[model samples]
Target: MRSLLYSSLLALCGALWARAFAQAAATQKRSVPPGFVTTNGRNFELDGKPFAFVGANAYWLPLLNTERDVDYTMQQIQASGAKVVRTWAFNAINETELPSATETGLTYYQVWNSSDWVVNDGPQGLQRLDYVVSSAEKHGLKLIVTFGNNWAAYGGIELYINWIYGAENATHDIFFTDPAIIASYQRYIKTIVERYKESSAVFAWELVNEARCTGDILSAGPNCVPGSNTLKTWYSQQSDFVRSLDANHMITAGGEGQFFSAHPAEYWFDGSLVSDYNFNGQAGEDFAGDLELPNLDFAGYHMYPQTWYPELDFPGSNFSVEEWGLGWISDHASAAAKANKPLIIEEFGVTGLQNKTDIYPSWVQHALDTGHARVMPWQFGVLGLTEDGGNRAIKYSDQIFRGASPNDGKTHSTLTRHKYGISSQRLRVFKANALDSH
Candidate 1:
């Protein structure tokens, strides 16, 4: 009798699993909110509304360069006030769809990887975008799509001969300078933007990753295209393209450090601004009156302090969590003023270095204190997921809220909801009271 009962239970369990799998398949097809923009809501807004984002970028996409891990990592991110998640086009969109493999619309290794530029539309690329867009919606997170990278930053002889210009080998080449490159890139961007236009999960269409100056292009160029000039031209073209197709959504360029400095070369896109921040550059440069970039609709900044500067590294390693917090806070204040726009602490977090420490609270407090930039701490489970694990993953129990581990089979999540207790209301109230006195 006992044996028979166990067998019956096993059969029921198997049936349930099969049914659940089918449901998931159905859900994928069922229309999901592509992504969202907080034009006027509390977390985020569209035109004149309150639009804030507490998010992070999924840097390592394993299947495509650690992207397989992103689905898992996002579970932890959702728990950490991350309403939006960013991904590169190569890692997230269809790349090889272009006419020639030499075309470059969006690539993974714009900074480091060296893959032949291929026409997008590969099954892998399509699947990747659908999976991410669908998955982000399922998990209540928004997607910020970046079209390009600053690969031009690491320009050298080899880069020039092989990568950009494609000398000896016709295969490896950057399609940007090639006149033929325009249509294909336009197609790729359109495909993505069109597909996800109705997606409420999509926050905004970011034209490019970083608007690196022409001089800063990794490989030297002929006319020496100015970063601002090149970006402005590119942004204008793409922005027009996106607007023509999808007029409902917002558009922005991934402008980080450029907005903080006083360099005239940094100026571009006269209409609306989507400012980006990196805590490493000119730490305390004021954003409002200091930079004169007050025409911003929204301010976005990246916060990966410890990774860039080892001195500012988090606790259990070199720098104390408190010290790191101060560094981030100072940067946040500067950018917030210059923006005079809603704040998006776009990219901020501790890296997954072997010597990992939990300085999340340091990050939380800074955001809490200012109430200026909506805080999106560095990351969720990118590093290791626990103290017992290797790299720089946050503790699941310490930071995350309710969420399942996408990588439960391989890694345990150390993230918890407790870490995010720095109340937004409390932070605002505190700042207000403190300010009145002054």
Candidate 2:
């Protein structure tokens, strides 16, 4: 009958409408809005909802050779439930301009050619970063791109100082005060920020990887003594400069949470001479003061009490690893609360020999329980590579130290995989705690 046909047509129309509505809702959920990440009180907000995460450091992501490698790294990161990643955005290098073959058979190394300082082009340049950003988007991971380095590994501050002051005259302090060096750094920052300003995959911009004054180019020393205001001023300038360029993203001074003299006296682990060299109250970094900067969004610190203060008979002693780590977290979290910002453990890990696999998840639980935003372990390793073959495990180092042997290849690879498992566990903890907190 005509009435039966009319009813069937009405049902079909209703079904089509419902399907379209469902598809639209799914699309909206998948698409993160522009400037999607923002701070709400002490927590991060993304797409109008609170965002808490367990992130990891993939410092060498851009150095990976192919798109497949980059994609694989992201897959591993996502598999571990890490929603954010910290990576290096700078690689300062000395290049030589070869003369025409007919003219001369001589080559000269150039360190200061402005044109050669291309941060956005070439195979190993920002094009690689572009792929990282895109792949991270594909894998649903966010990036915290650090602008420079404090160590010499990736042509750090020393390279910039050497370019302007020559190797003999270069000092880490000059990188902060010298007008020419500051200008050069600002130009590099401008280049990268402008290029990636529109990408939602970028979660934040860190000023440097463990920004510190290491005295001069020749000495591998602890941070420079904190007698002057140059370092603080430099942090403010760089952070404000980034804010000026990109109004959407967050900023953090990538300091080591080396507290100044005002740090609580109880948390001071001055039991060893190494502490004097590494954690002296005068180590030119003020975590609390740095957070006071208006442009800086959050605070970050690394926890390596086992390595940094080894004299404190940990493991079996009253000062257990968990106690030591929890103390640091408590102190930094208190400081962040006072600053009215969220705290993130940007780096923390124990060696394979220490056998503290549970510590990673414990730290994550402690961080979430104590109102901290997130905890990112020291690093995530690449697949199919051993320590001897140049894959640095989270805890094992390929670089030989004075009294320690290089990490045993197979053992370290196993430990690295085990650490990945720990990270996966930490993610579970974060998820469970996040649900409870909400």
Q: Candidate 1's residue-wise lDDT over 1-438, tens digit each? A: 111111222222222322222222111111123333533211234343333444555533322213444556666566544556676554322233232212322222223223324433444345556667777777887777766555432122123334334444332223334444556457657767877788777767776555443223233343223222343455556677887887656666565533334443221133543232332122222333322321123455555544445543435554464464566566655554434334555655443421122344334445544554354433433333332222222222222113322232112123322232334454444334333332
Name the 10 consecutive residues with the lowest summed lDDT in model 2: 1-10
**Model 1 lDDT at residue 353:** 24
Per-residue error at 384 for model 1, in Å?
12
Question: Over 4 Å off in model 2, which ranges?
Answer: 1-35, 96-120, 215-224, 263-280, 313-319, 384-415, 418-438
Flag clash pairs in model 2. Answer: none
For model 2, how does the per-residue alpha-carbon lDDT over 12-124 read when each residue is reduced to its tens digit? 22223222222221111223356458775566768876576767777767755457757876776776556789988876555543233113211111234532354436554
TM-scores across all candidates? 0.54, 0.74
Runs with alpha carbons beyond 4 Å of true place in candidate 1: 1-35, 40-43, 46-53, 60-81, 91-122, 152-184, 214-217, 220-233, 259-297, 307-338, 351-359, 382-438
Each prediction's number of clashing residue pairs: 73, 0
Q: How large is the C-alpha RMSD of every model relative to the true structure? A: 14.9, 12.4
